[model samples]
Target: MDLEKPARPPAAAPAGEGCLVVAVRVPVRIVVLVLVVPVRMAWDALVVAGRSLNDTLLRPLGRALPWVGRAVFVWPFAGLWRYVLVPSGKGLAWLGKVLVVLPAVALHRHVLTPLGRGAVWVYARVLTPVGHVLAAIGAGVRTGALWLGRCLVVVPSAWLYRWVLAPVGRAAVRCAKGLARLVETVVAGIGTGLYRGARILLVLPALAVWHRVLAPVGRVLAVVAREVGDALGHAWRVAGYVSIAVGRRLGTLLRRVFVEPARWVHRSVLTPVGHVVRDAVLRPLGDAARAVGRATRQALAAARASVRRARADLRRTLLGGQTGAERKPQLTHRREPNGPRTRTLDGSTTALTKD
Candidate 1:
């Protein structure tokens, strides 16, 4: 048992590829690469930009769009369906059930069902017996007709066919067979002549044209088509490589010129400046704002307490020595037990004691 994989055979060279194809392929590939590289780079750039735009802007917008639509369009329609349309539909359904469905049901049950039952009863009791009587009469008539026809027509036809018509028909058939043989021979000769003439005039010439003229032209066209297809495939592959190389070089140039310097500025300059601003300016501002808020809240609380004391003193001087807050709340409703206690052995409510 050999476990090793078999070596594949080398491919044969294409018989159709000539000097013309070889000469065309190099220049075509070079020209195609030049033309395609710019387009490919633009395509790649557009693809990258589209992905970035989708990530940065369009995806968030798409996610937000459902909520916006719910707020603007969906919620209002839902409210209308829930509050207005649903009730209207239910009311209409109830009205239709009352006006249409109920009447139809009553008519079917009271009027149509009884009428259908009566029609079925009449068909079964009266019409079925009458149909049976007519069928019996028709069968008797048919039997009499068949007997009379056998006596008057069928016996005579049998005798005529056996004695007179059969002998004449046999003589006629013999003559017809002889005439048919003669006609067949003449037709076969004519058909043979026509076939030969048609072959000489039409078929042979058409065959020659197909073999001599069309076959060579078709083969040349096939060769040219194959060469053109191969050339195109080669050119497309070369163009892809050229496009990738150009894109990498352009990307490197752009990164070196713009991205590195911007990164350096952000890391080395802006970050330190931001830190300094946070410590020096924003921190002190936040602390001062918090202290001001605390002082305002304390002053407002003190003022509120002073107002309450003044109100309490005014109430004592004016209205009999008590403010409303000092008065006790009165009970309006009483709390009660859930039910009476269960009977014990000593109680008369027990079954034995009652008996």
Candidate 2:
């Protein structure tokens, strides 16, 4: 008769847990693991023993085998090639070499070298002595000739000039001095008279004419010429300015009439025409080329794929399917662990371990 309202439905078990739960459960896999662990431990012990044996004893021999192979088998060939084969080949090569080289050496020693020696001896003994004698005789003759020229011709010429020519020259110079003194006395009187007469007759009249008449005329003419020159120069400068202005106007007119129209035609008409041609003809060509290139690449890829497939099949057949082939994406299967799978918010199934 005392019903406690069913404990008020357990008061909603708080916000985190709906109800209290307590259970003693053991998984079947855990029981299986209990049996598997002993066998697995024994197997692992055996494997560890084998690995220890391999590491301590067998792997050392494996490591040394390559070095032994190199030393025992390959080293003999290398030594033979270097010591025996190479030397034997070189010796055999000398056997053939003697055929040509011995004859050449014999010819040089017997015929050619003897002739060369005889010619050298003759040049050294006969021709060299003759050349030396000729050179000495020529040198002696040149020295004698130079001595004769100096003593015979040069000394006599100097002596004759010293005694004979110096005395005659001194006598002639004394006579010329006496004649020059008498002529100078007469010429001085006549030059003084002529100078006074010429001054009165010519110089005074010329100076009076130049100062009274020519100087004034020249000044007037200079003034008129200066004025005319200034006017002409001004006119020339104005003409030059006019010419430059006209040239600039003509240049501007020609540029507007010719260059601008040509530029406009090229910009508006020819450029568009060229672009249209390129788009029509060249663009299609370029597209076709690209398409051909793409097709070629695709064909090469397909051919390579087929070749790889053929090679894979051949290997599989030859090896009796021992060639491990990669599986396709959908055909792949994985034996999952015995753990819970949680569906993530992103809808991917993720297996959570028992940790």
Candidate 3:
């Protein structure tokens, strides 16, 4: 809404009144300058000077001091191996020496020492007496067992050996002698005849059969096996030759059917098709895609420029500048002659302008 003022003639204030107002404001500003302005200016000047000094001189000096010392002073003496590495090595050695002993000492004082003492005390106070008593008891048990074994087992076994086992053993010996004599008599009467009968009845027949029957059969079977093996060897050789011929034919068939035909089709058919595709399809499609990408990029750039301009205008407005009075550039379009036409997303052909 326009708050339109009615047009009227300007009313002039008296010159004296304007002069009086100026006069009053001038003294007040002078008083403020005397009181507040000097202090604030002093503080701001000091802060700026200090910060500038720190940034330019102090910071550079601080950085240069370390670099200069390391390069000039420290590095010059760093090559003295004894002065540099020896002290550090000694310090580390001392540290390791001290630290290693702490654990060992702690173990001996807190654990091993107590454990050894406890073991000695236990052995002296408890196990020593117990071992003596155990030894006495063991000795008594051994002596008693020895006495019992001699009285019960040894004496009784001796009596059994004298009274029962001795007589039985003597009778067994006599019986064994009589049995031997009888065996000798039987051997003399029948052993020779039996041996001759076995030779005639079983051994000689088996030997004759082995020599006449089994041996001849084994030789015949061996001859038949040898002939069969020879025939199988001949058949295997024939099959191997036939297989070699068949494999050669198969190799030719496979080459003609698969490898050669595949190569021919790739050369005669696929190559031409690939050229046609590259020319008719891929080239035009790539051109179209590049054109579309350029158009999209141009549109996006324009939108971004517009957004940036809007943001700048908004910032100016926020910073107390007049917002509505900023002159915005207008886009204009002109038609081109014999130029490639660009289509909008909506399929409209619009004129384009450079500016």
Candidate 4:
């Protein structure tokens, strides 16, 4: 018996070993794979489906549970009154009054008191100054507007008289003079024609009347009548010429005095007034408008900031991890193989071994 140290019994085949010798029929691995893969897949799918179902069903329940619990607890007190204390009409009415009173008292304490205090504080601290500033600005603007309107009215009137009415008036006067001259020329021409016609008609009538009647009379009487008629005619002609000359002179003088002075006043007073109005009234109005614009912008900016702060508060209340209802920590489970196991230094799983 070669008692060499009993050859270490061939290391026991690995735990998951197959039979050897005589061509040990290795069970077809395909069968195991087909069974195990499907079963693993089905189990994983079932686990995932179950988790999804739990999440879907429980999420809304979690959100509503607290409110439902409160309602359930409160229902008892409500039921006690309805069933025991308020079974009769009078008792029900009394219960109703109690309910109303309690709510009223609660509202007074929680809402009305705080709201009133805040309103008073705002009125005292914020509204008064704003009102005063707005009133002062309004008053200034109104006064400026009134002054500007007056200047606008007066200045335009003056300018119209000076620049537009004066020249127009002067032109009208010249046109009137030209028309008068034309009329005078036409009248003179007409008068001359009438005189020639009258001379021809009168000469025939005079010859007939004079030959028939005055020829029988003395020559001295006819000659005297003729001289008187000639003197009257000459005086009338001189008077007509003097009247036209006087009328022309008066019209020229009137136009110069009234129309020219109006033009001068418009230029001297109205133009300067318009300029002054633009500088004094319009400039201040522009400044006030700019200031109001700035104030409005500032108010808008403050309002935007306040709104942002409110939104931030809402976000923190609704979406913050610690306080929010929707944001909950997830729980996970991991399974590890049992028995003595080995792992790589990098924390990867390794095959188990038996010593």
Stretches of model 3 off by over 4 angstroms after superposition: 1-172, 187-191, 307-355
lDDT values for all models: 0.93, 0.88, 0.90, 0.84
The segments of candidate 2 whose C-alpha lies over 4 angstroms from its true place after superposition are 1-191, 322-355
TM-score of 3: 0.42
- For each candidate, give its TM-score against the true structure: 0.44, 0.38, 0.42, 0.24
Clashes of each: 0, 0, 0, 0
Q: Sort by TM-score, best first.
A: 1, 3, 2, 4
The C-alpha local distance difference test score for the whole of candidate 1 amounts to 0.93
* Tens digits of lDDT, candidate 2, 164-227: 9999999999999999999999999899999999999999999999999999999999999999
Taking the tens digit of each residue's C-alpha lDDT, what string does model 1 give over 213-268?
A: 99999999999999999999999999999999999999999999899999999999
Model 3: residue 107 alpha-carbon error in angstroms: 23
The better candidate by lDDT, 2 or 4, is: 2
Output the worst ten-in-a-row residue range by lDDT, candidate 1. 330-339
lDDT of prediction 4: 0.84
Better of 2 and 3 by lDDT: 3
Candidate 4, pairs of clashing residues? none
RMSD of each: 23.6, 31.6, 41.4, 52.1
Query: What C-alpha lDDT, on a 0 to 100 scale, does residue 307 get in candidate 2?
Result: 90
